[model samples]
Target: MAVSSYMTDAIKIDVWSDIACPWCYIGKRNLETGLAEVAGDADAPRVEVTYHSYELSPDTPVDFEGDQTEYLVQHKGISREQALEMAARVTDVARDAGLDYHFDNLKHTNTVKAHELVHFAKEKGLQGSMKERLLSAHFVEGRHVGRIDDLVELAVEIGLDADEAREALISEKYVEAVRADEEQARAYGINGVPFFVIDGKYGISGAQPPAAFSQIARQVWAEHQGEPAAV
Candidate 1:
């Protein structure tokens, strides 16, 4: 088999998601699992994943007064009972993906500052780590992601400079970068997440299964090699 230059180069994956999004975390796990599966192949190309900003609830207050259920009830226009049922279903799905979601403890807030922190981490080559930390903190630890102080603490936990991160968030240094991502998401016709643009061509929406991710990767790899994808 002849290996093309594309096979050797890394595949670029741009993911648009929000810290407050449960499905985004699950999709992240699935994407990682799928990439790992493909990586076991000797001829597989490496993937470079970059997460972008997408606020599920941009108008959400930094300090929301109610619980996840109440927020859902008010925002989603569902009853409290329905909100609980929805949370339970999402919790189960997240647990299956190895995520410990605590809706009861979740503090729903605007994620713009968190997104800015991510961009700061990206500048430091720690975007993935920062994103994971922010998600885990928000969903599992019930941490406040919308505040500069809280985000700075999380940044330090990931080995980022506390002072630098604080300044970045305070000055909204990466606000435009975050906005640019949102703009691009709009341009791509993505109204929801976790939306993925793989290798700048393939688009995958929602929290797809791990197999779905691996299959797409393999198909893309095959196409790069000018070969028909294996069914």
Candidate 2:
């Protein structure tokens, strides 16, 4: 008898998101749940995930105050009651996904530089950690992610060299990479965050429920199984 690995088929899901977008985080959690459920699903197929970038507000201020309710009412022109309702809805969604969002204290920063940093971090194999830290810093600690000093320090906290991180930020390395993702997002007609593309073909948008995402992913995965071999 010979031992064999569990070599099932694979599905690639490319997700486009901005850390500043609460729904993106909510979507991230939902997609993960969907993926895990699919992996163990009796009817669905397994998959892999890769995150792509999409800057929600590339022009947001660097030192802006962290009060999202105020920001929405003042900046985006949302009414106070509307802002509160929106926040409340998002809070409920996050809770469903097991997330503890600190929207009240979240620092709203221009995420362009942070997105650029992620482009570079992805090259260094630290994409996942960098993404997590950046989001947590903005959403949890109220850190100004747009500042080079703050971002570099956060990078260091997540195990990268501070000086090197600073250099990357100052030199604007990988700026084009971030721009490229933006371009791609535009090409895809993506005007929102938390968009998911399955195998470069199907597009799924919004922070939909786990069951919804799981159903789409399973459908795509099954289709992938029967495609004719590339010549």
Candidate 3:
């Protein structure tokens, strides 16, 4: 007997987020909650979420010699006190979303390598799992996401071929894909994330409440059904 896969009539949700961004993780959690809510509703539409790249601080060095608070103060031109305050607020928000954000130990670095890993995973249909693992590694485990070796380990942990993933990154195979996402984000005028694009038309920004996502998803799925199929 041939093995079959489970599938659904899914609404495409493209999300652009950075692993280093606390809100990105929270947004991911919120989106997952929303998708789960929709999936449970018999009349609601299913969602197929995809992760995309958006570097918050591309110029950051792979070996940034500071904690998150210091980096924010230097890059954003804020006082040390303010940086700590901002981090505290986001930490509280993340905690509410069932995330334990170790801001004090966050290893800040350029997320380009991490983003490239995401694209690699995308080609293998493992983007969602890879995305979550990278985010957790960066925000919770205080891992280095900017280096190729570190990323290779993470990719392997998720059952991806280690050699293939390493070669992909070293050769920059998906660099263009990451750039394409940035270009599309520019076209969309998205300056911040985690930004969500539904069916390539509807745009939702920020870590919105789960209820909000469910409501819009239902509305869009209903509207989508009314339209005739493409020629």
Candidate 4:
């Protein structure tokens, strides 16, 4: 990760992720676990988690057919066997994080629009729930985040105004914020989801165990006191 500017006080965590990515979902849970352990109250650390956009399959076709096996082999240059193996590996990882991943039913639609929806969610002060909903829609409920009507339906189910959500999706509003997030990821040399930057100075990458994130959160807290590093 590129060096983010400095900070002396509360941590500012900006997570770059794609809702379609299973690891991103687990990463969110793991990071939250860590954050909870490190804080005094349940919401301790008083985190302000801003979700940034990173499309895993930006050029993915608007509509795709068949199992993910064929999709991966054809689009990602991986063989069917390799793709299945990869899915199994990711499934195991998600399971370790206490999630049930059903890749078989997963409809891998282009997530650029979903990312756009998240940006709009941010403006609506519903980014957190919207992110959670989007992830569940894709990973658990098998909703098609790539389709405007489906996405609008899910957005409304999550308490967002349905009409507004549909309008924004169709009008492509708040796309610049999504693009800015992607650009920031590129500028920071981020190539994967679940990348976390805490306190603007302390950096962490990948969906590490919650203990790791808790340790870093405490460490950042210690830095504020100029005390020895917290274990």
Candidate 5:
């Protein structure tokens, strides 16, 4: 965690994550829970959340030749038993966050195009929807996120113009945006997924519990108001 910049007014949270990252999805759910907890407080700052790009497995093939277990066993250099154990551990964590993680059905593929679609959706004011859809498509429904047709169809499902999304992906329109986000992540010393930067001041890493994020939100709100720190 490193200090970036600041704003004493409304709160802004920028998240750097990837669609293929399970912990990122859990982190998202926990963040929403945190926001809900703070929403009841009249003194809480207005919060705006933005998602950025971070590819956890950039080297994964567009059409991955194996399943998640095999990929983990190969890419992570773990035994088959270890890969299954890791998946089970993450599955339980995701379940706690209300995510039905079907790792067996998950399609492990390159997420560059999916990240590009997120940027494209951001331009259309639907980045959040796109992010959720992409995550669920990969983790829950086992959709192939690397393919253009599947991504375009998912974009259309979220009310985005299919033609525009297709064209953007074809032309690599948002590749620079994705790269810029990665550069910012690197500069922030964020080497992990599900990193949250709050108000450009506080950095929270990993899929922490809702209480952890809520506590920070309360503290940030109190600080901005020049009041004693909230308990």
Candidate 6:
């Protein structure tokens, strides 16, 4: 049986996010929920998701001097009490999205190497899994994501080759790929994490509600249906 292009063609979703960014994790969960909501529809298009690199704090040290709260206070110039309040609000929102964020345990670090790891994972067709693992390790498990050894360990946990992963980071193989993604993000005039480029046409920022993702999916699918199927 001949399949229609609508069923065969995938709607590409390019997501720019930082592993260290709490909102990016929440946005990841929300985007997944939104995609799943429309998966059961007969007319729904297959969605292809690719996570791009965006380092929220590129200048941060690998071993930060203090905790997440202290970093926020220093960088954002907010009071300690305000940082705590902000963390609590974000934690509550994360819980609503079924994510348990442990701000106290989080290790603030530079994410450039982590972003490079993601680029390597993409080549192995495990980018999604790698990205999820990195986020959970940073937000929930309080793992160190900046070091090469640590990232290799996380990659092994997700079935990637530890030696290969380590070598990739040690040799800085995917650093340029990471930089390319950031360059593209800048070209798009994006200065924030958790940004979504849907079908390469629509740009959605922040952790929007699940309905927003589903609505955009349906709208894009409808537009694709109007075009003639490829021969």
Which one wins on TM-score? Answer: 1
Give the root-mean-square deviation of each candidate in angstroms. Answer: 1.8, 4.8, 5.0, 4.3, 3.8, 3.3
Model 4, CA-based lDDT: 0.82
> For candidate 1, what's the RMSD?
1.8
Best by lDDT: 1
Give candidate 5's TM-score.
Answer: 0.95
By TM-score, rank the candidates, best first. Answer: 1, 6, 5, 3, 4, 2
Which ten-residue region of model 3 has the weakest summed lDDT?
Answer: 1-10
Clashes (candidate 4): 0
Task: Tell me how far the alpha carbon of residue 126 in candidate 5 is from the true structure, in angstroms, after superposition.
Answer: 0.7
Give the higher-lDDT candidate: 1 or 5.
1
State residue 3's C-alpha deviation in candidate 6, in Å.
Answer: 11
Across 138-210, the per-residue lDDT of candidate 2 in tens digits comes to: 7666677888888888888878888888888899888888888878989999998889988788888999899
Candidate 6 lDDT over 160-183, as tens digits, reads 999999999999999899989999
TM-score of 1: 0.96
**Residue-level lDDT tens digits of model 5 in 1-231:** 122233346678999999989999999999999889988887655788999999988999999988888999888999999999999999999999999999989988999999999999999999999999999889989888999999999999999998999999999989999999999999999999999999898999999999988888888877766678856
Model 3's lDDT to the true fold?
Answer: 0.88
Report the candidate with higher lDDT, 1 versus 3.
Answer: 1
Instruction: List per-prediction Cα lDDT, in the order shown.
Output: 0.93, 0.79, 0.88, 0.82, 0.91, 0.92
Candidate 6 backbone collisions, by pair: none
Assess every candidate by TM-score: 0.96, 0.86, 0.92, 0.90, 0.95, 0.95
Model 6, CA-based lDDT: 0.92
Whichever of 1 and 6 has more TM-score, that candidate is: 1
Of candidates 6 and 1, the better by lDDT: 1
Give stretches of model 4 more than 4 Å off.
1-9, 40-44
